[model samples]
Target: MNQTQILVIGRHPEILATVIRLVNNNPAWNATGCITDEEAMSTFDKQTFAMVLLGGGIEEPSEDKLCAYFTSRNPDIKIVQHYGGGSGLLSAEIYEALE
Candidate 1:
């Protein structure tokens, strides 16, 4: 099965881990979490991501850079801002983005 690759970027390690865990729980999704801009860029470069979930705590500057980079790489890439929500909301956000 071809799983949907998701790039999860957050400033907080705990939040990043939790987001990754929740995303990966679904058989259709696979998440790669990063806590730093460098790490996120590196991972994103090495892997093809269908969607990017920007978690809480990310600085506006960093988010802009990442979004620009992602857009440059894949103009059609789906990007979502996820902050302080339950797994249900997260799932809904992702599903909505996919549409």
Candidate 2:
């Protein structure tokens, strides 16, 4: 079966790890986490993701830059600002984006 692709970016490694774990829990989804904008962009350029999860620790400037870069690459891309919520909210956000 094919799985949905998701790119997650967070400033904190621990938070990013948690997000990655939660995202990977879903059998139908696959996620990649990055702690830096450059890494995120580099990963993004290598593959296509249906959605992007931005962590709370990300700065406004970085967020703007990332969003701009992603939008430039895929205007229809889905971007979500995730603030360390439980798995339920994360799933809901992902489901909502796919909807």
Candidate 3:
């Protein structure tokens, strides 16, 4: 079985770690976390991610740019904003986006 690759972008280390852990809990999913837009863009260039999750720690303008970057690269890529919800909500959002 192939797992879905998820790229999580956030400025906070703790939140990024939590999001990575939650996404990886499901066997069908794999996740990578980036602390800055530069890191995220670099990783995105090297990877084929199915989705990108923008965490609450990222500012509005940065998030917008990241979203634009990813979407421009892959027009159909799924990008979702995450605002520190529980693991369940996070999981649900991810699955929904993938679906």
Candidate 4:
């Protein structure tokens, strides 16, 4: 089976690193981390991602716009929410559903 590709939008280096590690550690994911919304959007426009991780610090308007754009472009992509510091953003059920 092919691993799912994930795009992460976050500012903090530590949080991005942790998320990259988590997603990469999972046998099912191919994680790629981006710091800025522009970079994330650029990546999104270039390639298809199975999921996207949105950091709490990210501007909701920009994130929402991106989500809408990506969903319109490809409805199969899932957007998962996350906090800036670490985990616990989504409930286990939501996480499992996103996964």
- Model 1 clash pairs are none
Name the 10 consecutive residues with the lowest summed lDDT in model 1.
Answer: 10-19
Residue 68's lDDT within candidate 3 is 89
In model 4, residue pairs whose N, Cα or C atoms come closer than 3 Å (at least 3 residues apart or on different chains), thus clashing, are none
Clashes of each: 0, 0, 0, 0
Candidate 4 C-alpha error for residue 41, in Å: 1.1
Over 4 Å off, model 4: 84-95
Question: What are the lDDT scores of the predictions, listed in order?
Answer: 0.93, 0.93, 0.92, 0.75
Candidate 2 lDDT, tens digit per residue, 3-40? Answer: 99999999889888988999999999999999999999
Which 10-residue window in model 2 sums to the lowest lDDT?
A: 81-90
lDDT of 2 at 9: 95
Steric clash count of candidate 3: 0
lDDT of 4 by residue, 11-81 (tens): 88887888788667667668788998778888998987878878667777887887887788788888877
RMSD of 4: 2.7
The deviation in Å at residue 18 for candidate 2 is: 0.8
C-alpha RMSD of each candidate structure in angstroms: 0.7, 0.6, 0.7, 2.7
After superposition on all CA atoms, how large is the RMSD of candidate 1?
Answer: 0.7
- Give per-residue CA lDDT, model 3, range 4-97, as digits (tens): 9999988889888988999999999999999989999999999999999888878888988898899999999999988977999999999899
Q: Please identify model 3 stretches exceeding 4 Å from their true place.
A: none
TM-score list, all predictions = 0.97, 0.97, 0.97, 0.79
